[model samples]
Target: MKKLIESLLRQALSALPVSRVPPDARPAEVDVERTRDAAHGDFASNLAMRLAKTTRQNPRALAEALIDALPGHPAVAKTEVAGAGFINFFLKDTAYYDEVARILADSGQYGRSDQGGGRSVLLEFVSANPTGPLHVGHGRHAAYGATLGNLLEAVGYRVTREYYVNDAGRQMEILAVSTWLRYLERCGETLEFPANGYRGDYIATIAGQLHEAVGGELRRAAAEVFSGLPADEPRGGDKDAYIDALIARARALIGTDAFRRVLSVALDDILRDIQQDLGEFGVRFDRWFSERSLEDDGSVDRALAALEKAGHAYRRDGALWFKSSAFGDEKDRVMVRDNGVKTYFASDIAYIFNKLARGFDHLLYVWGADHHGYIARLRAGLVALGGPAGCFEVRLVQFVSLYRGGEKAQMSTRSGEFVTLRDLRREVGNDAARLFYVMRSNDQHLDFDLELATSRSNENPVFYIQYAHARVASVMRQMQGRGLEHDGRQGLARLGLLVEPQEVALMKRLSQYPETVEQAALQRAPHLLVHYLRDLANDFHTNYSAHQLLVDDPALRDARLTLSLAAQTVIRNGLGILGVSAPESM
Candidate 1:
């Protein structure tokens, strides 16, 4: 419908006299938008006002001339100039009737479009380190990224959802050492767990699995493992240095091969756990891009070489530094330290290079709010490596606070006290969790109220939208119970019988689905879709309450039934994109 109005406006512009609308004054693109109020019209365009400055004419006079030159169309019942030369288009009822029929015909494909022009997009998200279970915060990233990928795909973008596994970092080594310490405890050896170690109970679970695999063969005496080790933070020592020393001692005591096996076991187990958690949450990645693979495949060296050749890299104080400050970063970043270890930033740039090499037109990163500072350096690195600056983008998701009843729920991943995504799903179910996670904008903090989400009332947006769908199904079943069969062809043929104010309003809202989806996808905002579904469901519920869907008149009954089915289809499609199910019954 928006496209139709734009086309008509373009025709009107071309029909105008060359003196009134010169070639240079004419707009290359017409901007048609839905009117906020019913009194204004179905759609409105400010083309006349936009051209007024260039043409040196009064906007109202230009609008009148454009309306006079506007070509006639059956779908547009009338066009009127409103405040400040706004051309409002009042669409005919037949137009909305046709839209309802189109909705029925398209079914699941109704709200999608090819607006993206088939551009390739690489979406990297929730690449949480595999050292612990995914807490509630990671759940947001998973849901947001997954739904955003769905939205992008719906709009015809070739999207590749990816998870960058931080498997090559020091965190994994700490996890291995943590597991080994627990293994020694299983062998009746006493040791003080490092403050920096991953102390999650899942670590002990992994330790038990390690024990089952290798028994006490890898165990060393607690004294030997902790001998000559620096005091931990609890004893006024740097926890980082202490953990590194502990890791070295473990390797020396158990041999490098044994240490590697332990690290592999912990990494594989935790990563599998993460994969399962996300899979169950309806979030699946096309690839789990390994950080270790970047180094293994020599991509890091290549990226560094690109930076060096571009004259964006230089050595300073025995460290290889990228001149990120040259590209607007606050300070230069070290890609490799004096100790000859590549920083995580090095792997990050390598990952960006990999994405570019894979031929993605755009690289979208979904990162936690804490990673906001890293975005500048990463983008600077991308530019330094000769990638287009506009091709890289980052979305920061704010923190999520879980609330049970009225009290804020505390969470800590290191201490294993956090609420896992699985736990949230099991308690509130996936439908509610998925909806609640994206109910607010990504940049806004989410206070996930446990009690409100599980409720089966209007207060819960998921249940309300789903109930609207279920109500339509109930109407269909009730019609069948009364020995009245719905003829879709008959319903579509008699759509003119839908004359009630509620019916017209519902149809108008239904027609906005495609536009709503397109706007949501273009803005990269899933919350807009959530709000639209709520509005759509509200319209459906209002019409259902005000009118009789299963009436005695067969034509009117079937017409309303068709409308109900169309509403159900749209509701289902929207929920599906959000990874929430649309139930047929409450």
Candidate 2:
């Protein structure tokens, strides 16, 4: 409906004489908006007032001229010049009646559009490290990213979902050592675990697996493992320094090859678990990028070489540094330490370079809110490597606070005292989990109420929407039981019978689906679609309650059924985008 009005307005503008309205005064794009008040009109535009000053004419007079030049269309009942030269359009009832037929015809493809124009996007999200299992927080990231990808593809964007594996870092080393310590304990060697080590129960389970794989082959005496090492945090020493020294000792005693074997075993086990968890949650990635691959493929060296050739890198105090401050970062960042090891920041830079080298039109990163400070240096790396500044984007997802009953549940990944995504899914079905996770904007803090989500009532938004779809199915069954059959052809021919206030209201809501999807995709907000579905469900319920679908008049009954089916189609399509099911029987 908005597009139709805009097209008519464009025709009117082209018909206007150039002497009265200069080409510069004409808007490049026509903007038509639905009026808030029914008394004004169905839609309104302020084109005349916008062009008045440039055209050297009175606003009201210009509006009259533009209205006169508008071509006649059956959808428009009348056009009026309101106060301040606003052009108001009162649409005919047939405009909305035809939209119902369009909806049923399009079915699953009704709300889709080609707004993105085939642009390519590389969307990276939920790239949690393989140090531990994914908790409730990562679950929110997965749901939001998956739905956002669906919304993007609906609007015609070519999207590639990715999860970057943080496989090369101190965190991985710590996990490896944690597993080894537990392994030694299982081999009759008792030792106090480091305060800074991963104390999760999963670490012990991995150690059991290691014992099953190589029994006592990698085990060492507790004295040899902890001897001469710095005091641990529990003993009033720096935990970071103690953990680093312990890692070095482990490598020395067991050899680097053996140490890497432990790391590889732990890494493979945890990564496999992550893959299974996400797969069950209906989140799949096109690629699982490895940070170590940047080093293995010489991409990091190439990135450093690019930076140096572009005069953005220099050596200072025995360390290679990137001039990040020149590109809007707070300070210069070191690419390589004085000890000849590349820093994580260097891998970050090369990662962005590799993404751009893949010929993506845009790079979108979904990161935690804490990583907000890292955006500048990363963008600096892109620009220093000669990528467009506008091609890079980041969306920060806030933390999630899980609530069971009234008390807020506390979570810590290192201690493994947290709720996993799989745990949440098991308690509440995936439909409810997916819907509840994205019930708010990504940047807004979410308090997921497990009790409310499990309830089977209208208070739950997912239940309300799915019930609306089921009611239509029930209506069809009831009609069949009454020995009647709906004739859609005749109903479409007799759509003029649908003149009730509830019918008009429902049809108006149905016509807004395409626009709602386009706006939601452009803003990258799934909550907008969530809000729209709720309102649509409310509208469907109100109409169903106020009228009867299986009436005596065959034409009216089929017409009502057509409307009901259109609503069902839209509900199914909307829920499909959110990765939630729309069931026929609630």
Candidate 3:
């Protein structure tokens, strides 16, 4: 209805000669908003008011002119210029009913269109460090990213979901140190732990697994590990302390340099655990790209060189700095320290290049909200590297607060108290978890209420939408059990009989599904689908509570069943795009 109205308005405007009113500078948007009062008409738009200033006339007068120019169309039965130049169009009574036929005709393909024009987009998200298990924040990101990718694909953007692993940073080094230290503890080596390191039982589990795999085969320890000096200072606070202790032990038994080899055993364990833990969360990335690969392949160095040559970089404090303020940043950033170690921002620069080189038309970074400041730096880096600034984009998601037992769920990986993605999924089930995570917008804070998500009642979206589908299936089954027959062809032919106001209302809601998908995909908003599905289910439930689908009245039965089937198809499609299942039975 909105598109038809907008198309009509555009056509009407195009017919006016520029000589008459001098073409309106402001473009018009035909928004078909549902009327709060039936007396106002069905879908209302402010096309005339929007055009008033451009046409140099009073809004009411412009509205009257727009109405006069409206062509006769079957879909729009009447157009009235209401108060303040609002153009409200009453959809034809038959048009509402015909949508039911269209629904049955299109079936599952009802809400999908090829609007992407073959553009390819890359979505990178949930790239949690391998130092520990994925926590609740990453869980929200995984759900949002996967659904966004799915939504884009539905609307025809060639999409790739990626996870760029930062496996070569200080964090990874800390993880390695922590694991080796835990190995020393298992081997009865006495060493002080670091003030800051990864804790949690998984570290020990990885250490034990590594020890079992390579117990006596690898020898030496003590001073050899601690040979790196800071032996006088506390090594670390968590698992890294344990690793530093083991390195000290290695240095004691062998030498300073050989202590580095001890990290291999720890790194292997961390990698294995990280893979298994996230794999359980249903977040499989097309790439687990290593930050190390960028440096190893000279990509990071090359990126720095390009930025330096472009005057986007400068040497300061014996370190390389990026002049990000030229593009828009609070201040310059360090690309490399005097010690020759590249900054994480430098890695991001290389990583983006890698993504673009793979042929993605656009690169999307889904980062936690804490990294909001990094946005300007990344954008500036892309420009400094001689790449178009439009190539890279970032979406910072606000924190998700998980509540259970009416108290805040405090999460810290170092204490092993954080809620792992696996734990959240196991408790709430994947469907509910995914739904809850995306229930709110990305920029808004989310309180993932555990009790609400676990409920199997209609108040719960997981069950509510599923129930609509199952109820429809139940009706279809009743028809089949009664030995009645129908298919899309018969359903479309008999849909005109579905004339009840409730039936027409339900069908009208179904007709809006395509636009909902298009808008949601365009805005990269999956919550819109959640809202649409809930509303669609409300319509279904209302119709179910008031009407009968399998009556002795064949004509009415056929019409109702067709409408029900159409609802089922759309509900399933919407749910499918969110990686959710619409069950035929609860």
Candidate 4:
């Protein structure tokens, strides 16, 4: 409908005489937008205001000329030059009636578009390290990313949902050593666990599995393991150094191959857990790209080589450095340290190169807000490697603070005290979890109120939206109980009977679904869709509360039913994108 209005305005502008509106004064695109006030009409455009300055004519006069030139269309009931220069378009009642018919006909496919132009987008998100189970924070990323992916896909983008597994480097090593220590304990060898090592009970579970797989063959005596180890953090030593030393000592005792086995076991177990958790949350990825694979395939070396070839790399203080500052970063970054170990940034660069090599027109990274500083360096690295600066984008999701009964819920992943995504989903349900996770802007801190999410009330947006869907179903069932079948054909034919204010409002809201989806996708804002759903649900509920659908008048009853069904279809489609279920019975 917006397109139809825009097209009419564009044709009107083009048909105008050059003397009144010059070729140079024409806009590349018409700007038709929904009016906030019903008195202003269904849709309005500021084309005249935009062209007035260029055409050297009064905006109101230009608006009048534009309106006069507009070709007559059945959908447009009238066009008025309103306050100053806006062209307000009052859509005909039949237009909305046709929209209701279209909604019923399209069903689940409604509100989708081909606006993406088939561009390939590699959306990498929630690439939280596989060292621990995903927590409440990761749950937000999962919901936001998954919904964003669904939105983009709905708009015809070839979106590849990816989870980059940080399965390499110090963190994974710490996890391996942590698993080994726990395995040793399982083998009856008591040793003090490192302060910086993973201490989650899940690690102990993995350790038990390891013991079952290899018995005590991979275990060493506690004395031998901690005999000459440096003081741990609890003993007034650097936790990072202590953990690193423990990892080395474990490798020496178990041998390099056995150490790799331990690392692989821990990595696979935790990765599997994360994959399962996200999958159960309705967040599936097209690929789980491994950081280890980047090194194993020589992509890291190749990426470094590319930097060096482009004169963006230099050696200083026995470390290979990339001149990231040259491309607008605050400072240069080290790619490889003095110990010949590559930094996580090195793997990130390789990952970027790998993504580019795969032919993605755009690369979007969903990262934690704390990683804001890393964006500049990563973009610099991409540009240093000759990738287009515009191709790289980052969206930082702020922290999610869980609250229960108005008290903050504290969490720490390393201490094994954090609320896992599984726990959250179990507590509030996947539908509520998904909806609440994305109810706010990604960059805005979210206080996920557990009480509100679980409450079966109108205040809960998820429940409210789902209820709107179920209300329509209940109405249909009631109609059936009264021995009246919903004749969709007859309902569609009698759409003209739906002329009440509430009915018109609901029809208008339904028509905005496609626009809402498109706007949310383009803006990378899932919160927009959430707010839209809330408003849409409110419209449906308002209409339902005021109007009686099962009336003695067959045509009016079916017309109202048709409108309700359309609302239900749109709510279902929106909820589906957000990974929230629209239950028939809320």
Candidate 5:
């Protein structure tokens, strides 16, 4: 209905004389919005007021002229020139009736549109390092990113979901050394683990598997492993330095080949576990991009060469530095350290380059809130490499703190004391986890109340919405039990009988779903859809209480059932996008 009105307004604008309104005065896209007050009209637009200054005409008079020129349409009952040149349009009841019919006809694809024009998007998210199992923080990334992808595709965007594996970093090295130490412990070698090592029970599990793979072949005596190691953090020394020294000693004792074997075993086990956890949670990626691939494929070298050739990089303090400060960074960043190893930023720079090279029209990076500072430098790298500024975008997801029994659960990946995504999912179920994770804006802090989420009462948003859907199904089952069949075609034909206030309100809310989906997709906000479904459910519940669907009159009964089924269809479609289940029974 909104689109039809916008088209009619455009026809009216085209009908206006060149002397009265010039081509440049016309808006590129017509803007017709639903009015707040029903007395004013159903929809309103301020085109006359917007063009008054440029055309030097009275806005009210211009509005009247535009209204007179509007094309005839059945959806629009009437048009009025409201105060200060506002064009108000009142839609006929048949307009909403047709919308309900459309909803039934389209079914699951009701609210989908081609607003995105099929532009390719590479969405990289939840690239948590394969050091340990994913914690609660990464759950937000997975849920948010997956839902965002569904929303984009719902609006016809070509979206590719990606997970970048941080397999080549100090963290990976730490995980490797940690697993090796545990492997020695399994081989009857008593040793004290480094303070910076990953202390999760999973590391010991991986070591047990490693020992099964190569029994004592890669293990050394405890004294040989820690003979000359620096003092650990427990001894008042730096934990990072001690960890680094421990990593070096591990390599020297086991040899680089044998050390890499330990690293590979740990990496494979952890990566496999991460994959299984995410898959079970319904979060799947189109690609698992390895950071090491950037180095193996010479992408990092290519990126640095491009920067150096473009004069955006120079040697400073015997290290290669990118002139990021010149491109809005607070200071220049190092591409390679003085020790002749490429820094993590070098991988970041190359990763963006690689994404662009893959022919993605846009790069949407979903990063943790702590990565805010990296946005500027990464964008600078993209711009320096001749990529469009608009092509690069980032959405920072805030931290997730889990509360159970009125206490905040502590999370530390290295300390191995954290709530994993799998743990949360197992407790609250995936439906609640998926919906609650996105119930708030990505930029805002979310306090996931487990008590509310698991409760069966109306306060639980997920349960409430699902109940509305099941309630409709219950109505149909009752109809069948009473030996009555709903005539959908007849009900659609006699939609005029649905004139009750509650019925009218449900139809109006149904009309808003398409707009809600488009807005949510364009704004990258899934919470909008969440709120919409809640409101829709509330309206449905209100209507269900006010009127009985299995009434005596067959025409009214079918009509009411048709409306109820339409509501159920929409709820299912919406929940599908959120990766949530819409059960037929609680």
Candidate 6:
């Protein structure tokens, strides 16, 4: 029905004089919307106002000309000019019912399309450093990224979900040193736990695994091991410096090769922990591109060379820096430090090239809000590496704050005091958790009120949407029990019986699912789908409450059944896009 309305609008636009709307200034699609107020007519558009200046005529006159342009389609009864310059369309009753049959006919595939024409898209998200378990803030990216992937796929874009593990740099180096320090104590050489060491209890779990792997060769008496260790406080302890010192000591005790092996084992343990946690949290990645792989492939060095050749780079303060400010960044960024260690930006530049080289048409990087400043440099890095400027889009998702029992739930990783995604799923269930992430725009901060989310009220949007689906199921059951034969099985040849005003309004909303998917994918906004689904569910409920699907009249029963089936198809399809279930019974 949405498509049909759009077609009708194009027809109207075509009929208008070339003087009013230029041949190319016309809108490609016309929307047959359900007005919030009945007095505004069934559906309205301001294309006339948009055309008035170009046509050099009053908007009201232009709107009238547009209204005169709409012909007698199988669906539109009439279109009127309203307000200053709005085209209000009134769809015929039969046209509304026709869309129901089309929707039911499409079934689960109702909203999907081949609009993307096989273009491949790469979606990278939630690339949190594997130093610890994922916190709530990362959960939003997981949800948004996954759902966006699904949305793009529905429109026919091949999408690969990826997580770039930052396992080749200082953060990982620090992690290794921290684990070794913890392992030393288990080996009986008591030492202070470095303040810079991973404070989460998960670190010890890795250390214990290292001990098991060494067959107690790393074991030590507890008294001697912790002898010089400071009490658990901010301390006179500088964790980073202490861990760096311990790393040096380990290299001495067991040559560089043996110490490197131990570090590898520790890294393996930490990486395993990360993979397990994220998997259980429902973030599935198509690829775990190792940061080391880029270095091995020479992409890092090659990318640096490109920057040098492009003259986008130079040495400053004994560091090789990319003049990112030349390309609109706040300031230049270092690709290599004075000591020759590559910066994270260098690694990312290589990774970006690797992604495009793999043949993805577009690259999307989803990062946490704290890293918002990195977008400009990353884009700059890409340009210096010969990739088109602005080809890469970096979306920063604001953090998530968890509140349980009306108080701020402290998330101090140092104290082992953060709620895991597993904990959130356990408390609120997966559906609620998924919906919570998309409840707001990605750039907007979301205050996820646990109490409100858990409540079984209209305020709980997930349940409300689900209930609409369940209610349709109930209607179907009721119609079946009434011995009413449904025309939805064999597409209804005649739908004129569905003439009620509310019926047409409901069908109009039902027909918008596909266009919503396309628009949401184009804008890279999943919240639009969220809001669209809610509106659709509300429309279904409104029709369900005011009308009966299984009326005594067979003609009416069949028509209504078609409408109900369409609603079911749309609801189910919508839930699928969100990675939520649409139960046949509930």
Candidate 5 displacement at residue 249 in angstroms: 0.9
lDDT of 1 by residue, 70-158 (tens): 99999989999999899999999999999999999999999899989999999999999988888899999999999999999999999
Question: Candidate 1 vs candidate 3: which has greater TM-score?
Answer: 1
Model 3 ranges off by over 4 Å = 24-32, 217-280
Worst 10 residues of 3 by lDDT: 230-239
Model 4: which ten-residue window has the lowest total lDDT?
Answer: 18-27
- In model 5, the clashing pairs are none
lDDT of 3 by residue, 333-372 (tens): 9989897878898998888777767888888889999988
**Which 10-residue span in candidate 2 carries the lowest summed lDDT?**
48-57
Q: Estimate each model's TM-score.
A: 0.98, 0.97, 0.93, 0.98, 0.97, 0.90
Q: How close is candidate 4 to the true structure, as a TM-score?
A: 0.98
Q: Please, what are the lDDT tens digits per residue for candidate 5 over residues 109-187?
A: 9999998899999999999999999988899999999999999999999999999999997888998999999999999
**Candidate 2 at 234: error in angstroms?**
2.4
lDDT of 3: 0.78
The whole-model lDDT of each prediction reads 0.92, 0.92, 0.78, 0.92, 0.92, 0.77
Candidate 5: regions farther than 4 A off: none
lDDT of 2 by residue, 48-161 (tens): 988887776899999999999999999999999999999999999999989999998889999998889999999999999999889999999999999889999999999999
**Model 4: lDDT of residue 476:** 86
RMSD of each: 1.2, 1.6, 2.9, 1.3, 1.4, 3.3
**Model 4, span 1-586: residue lDDT tens:** 8888989999999989998877877879889999999899999999999999887789999999999899999999989999989999999899988888898888999999999999999999999999888999999999999999999999999999999998889888888999999999999986778889889999999999999999989877788888787888889988888888888898888899999999999999988899899989989999999888999999999999999998999999999999999999999999999999999999999999999899999999899999998999999998988899998989999999999999999998779999999999999999999999999999799999999999999999989999999999998888889899877899999988888899888999999999999999999999999999999999999999999999999988888998999999999999999999988875
Candidate 6 per-residue lDDT, tens place, 2-69, comes to 56666667787898777657887766655556577867756778777777766667999888877777
**Local error of candidate 2 at residue 243 (angstroms):** 1.1
